[model samples]
Target: MGLFALLNRLFHHGPAWLTFLVMGLAAAGLALCSFNLLFLFQANYHLLFTYGAMAAFDGGLLQFIELTAWGYLAIACYVVAEGCLEGLLTRIRRAQL
Candidate 1:
């Protein structure tokens, strides 16, 4: 099975504390991702306001690319966190029925 399926199965059969721990970790991940995203935006504020002029400076292209990659990483983290939380919630709902 895929990673999500495996995780779902594990959470489904695991103790209640295990699910809660995973949920808490996921929530913390989401919060950290949000902060990283915000930091990326704030750090690039000058480049944004300059209308791409700052990108003409030395090493600016490399910095921009690095920032883009970091932004993607943060987004991926957010997606993973959301997925984990969703999976846990789905398991909980199914168990309640």
Candidate 2:
């Protein structure tokens, strides 16, 4: 029936509240990607122009003090970058709705 078709299209493709859920999952996936890359570049890898990662749990927070300021800074920067990307995706879903 036309009525069922209309409802189906609205829920499936047109603006609807459920779109927010899909957007959130997408944001999480993106953030995870960012976290992995950050972990790789700022901490994990050691190849030309790269420094090696420190054992985060070795001595706990106290050991953080031994890191160069840039190393410490990268940790904070990565968190913010990932959070912002998630927020952006959330807003995008709301906008579409």
Best by TM-score: 1
Candidate 2 has an lDDT of 0.47
Model 1 C-alpha lDDT versus the unseen true structure = 0.64
**Candidate 2: tens digits of C-alpha lDDT, residues 1-97:** 9965653443345443554444455455545444445444544333322422334444423333433444555554454445445555656787899
In order, what is each prediction's RMSD in angstroms? 3.7, 13.0
Error of 1 at 28 (Å): 5.5
Candidate 1, residue 57: lDDT: 64
- Kindly report which residue pairs in candidate 2 clash with one another: none
Every candidate's lDDT:
0.64, 0.47
lDDT of 1 by residue, 19-39 (tens): 667666766765664566666
Please report, as a residue range, the 10-residue window in candidate 1 with the lowest summed lDDT: 53-62
Where model 1 places Cα greater than 4 Å from the true spot, the runs are 1-57
